[model samples]
Target: MTTKTSQGRFFEDYRLGETIAHAIPRTLSGGERALYHALYPSRFALTSSDEFARACGLPAAPLDGLIAFHTVFGKSVPDISLNAVANLGYGEGHFRRSVHPGDTLRAESEVIGLRQNSNGKSGVVWVRTSGRNQRDEVVLDYVRWVMVRKGDFDAPAPPPHIPTLAATVKAADLRVPKGLDFSAYDFGQAGEPYRWGDYAVGEMIDHVDGVTIEEAEHMMATRLWQNTARVHFDATLRPDGKRLIYGGHVISIARALSFNGLANVQLIVGLNAGAHANPCFAGDTVTAWSEVLDKAETAVPGVGALRLRLVARKGGAPFRLRGEDGTYLPEVLLDLDYWALVPN
Candidate 1:
């Protein structure tokens, strides 16, 4: 079996209410857990320390919800974002259930709307993607929009039109999965030395550290997600016999990397944009870079807001995410924009 060349589609190819079932299945495991913890000192009260989880009424320590979201969203990259120019926004996201370690994840996408650009060169596509487990239960859901290049157009005359999205999910709109409760939360081991007030606008720092991924790790991650796309797992699936690492793995890795500098960031508030600029395979070591984008005040007094651009690349370079040609190198895997709850 071989991975499809799926060049993906442009704005012209999508219609309202059209669904796109992605072709990949992924699985999460202990390694993912270790990576998650190492990448961000994320104790989260529920994700780390099985002992704490049991006290919290969980059967065991659960995988972080954000990790699950990253895995589920990563599955859509090949089918939805391969040709995207910009990821406009994400909203209406709900974590409907808790995900534990060793659970398998799968994803599917539905096109909700599309609008063509008058320039005939680009357009935007809106999609709602849902993630399910091996048991076929809904675990995550969200709406995202992307700017895609136009594939073809016979005649173009209408002026370009674009859509807008909500800045944040309202409190009433937050669906914090059935089993999550802060009532039993443990505050000691989460590993942050500061709260909201420690942060100020215009701060930047490097999330110091590197992670080296292997074939087995990437394959296991892809399979766990039920991301059936062969290239991610099957060495024999490629003519070169090289198994491709899942793009989302790199995203998760990079996000975790941000924990080093953005240590006080408590919650992922917004996903402004993201990109898997290049393909990453096993055997490449990853390093991270980050830049503060913006900041704001939040409802949680001890927590302020920080928006950042996090990047992941192969090896220890000058942290230049792009190559000489301005294209992402095969070593570069992620260009992500997100908002987090951090120290003020």
Candidate 2:
């Protein structure tokens, strides 16, 4: 008998100290690489040219580290926080290795902490998730928490381990992708001249634009993330015959759209937390907006630091986020908090 029954998740299912393995393995390909560059317009030549990469000392152009992070993180959504009330924060994030095309990625989560709300209705669930490539090599590791419903109010609340997270990562903490030689970097063709100092804390900007998605686009993305979940591609997987969208696609699109205002964001330093606030499907016109959360200084000359929140939505007035109830709107598809290095 098929045991598939989903009407959206609520906070009650997570168990502290228990592990939940997210199904679906994804295998990224050239198509995803192409889409990633197109979406972000990133000028990190190493990602755009094999020749440049060879000169810098890599086997070939590598996928964006953010792309790999998004792919790995997106895999946990369904099993962990589909019904989450809020993403608490992220900690212990480190990229242990690089993932290239043709590499299949799989993810697993270990619940490390849990705390029931005093009201007894909902609680926080924390997990340290690790993403691994086909070779079983670690690609990334991070901690995240979400407010979930109690499966049973009588169930004892799990212990909470809210690890201390850095407010801003130093440039020395950056894992500059190997073989990346900025010495030969082309700033003119790299897109923008604004370095780190250009950004300030608490600033907000709307990246005004939209890109209509197609089936081929999403299916390819789902596959690249090695997220084999049928919902993201197979039309027959669901009763409605609708192709489920890949969460990573939304992440990449939103990050790319964030470029409008975060154009000078040179390096990603920290990932505080993230969420796909809602489901996304084909034919959806995705748009993006950003808010500066914090700022810091990196060791690199002329490099500044900016923490940003990037949100993606379907369509409508270029308005900011808020629900009718004064909460963040449900139409919002993402709530990603991360840090980037920009021009000083």
Give the per-residue lDDT digits (tens) of candidate 2, residues 197-251: 5555666788887777788877766655555444665577567788767666777
RMSD of each: 6.6, 5.5
Output candidate 2 Cα RMSD.
5.5
Residue-wise C-alpha lDDT for candidate 1, range 228-319, written one tens digit per residue? 45456557856777877766677777766766656545456456667667667778887888877776664543345666778888864635
Q: By summed lDDT, which 10 consecutive residues of candidate 1 come out lowest?
A: 172-181
True lDDT of residue 57, candidate 2: 52
Would you estimate the TM-scores of all the predictions?
A: 0.63, 0.68
Candidate lDDT scores, in order, read 0.67, 0.69
lDDT of 2 at 125: 78
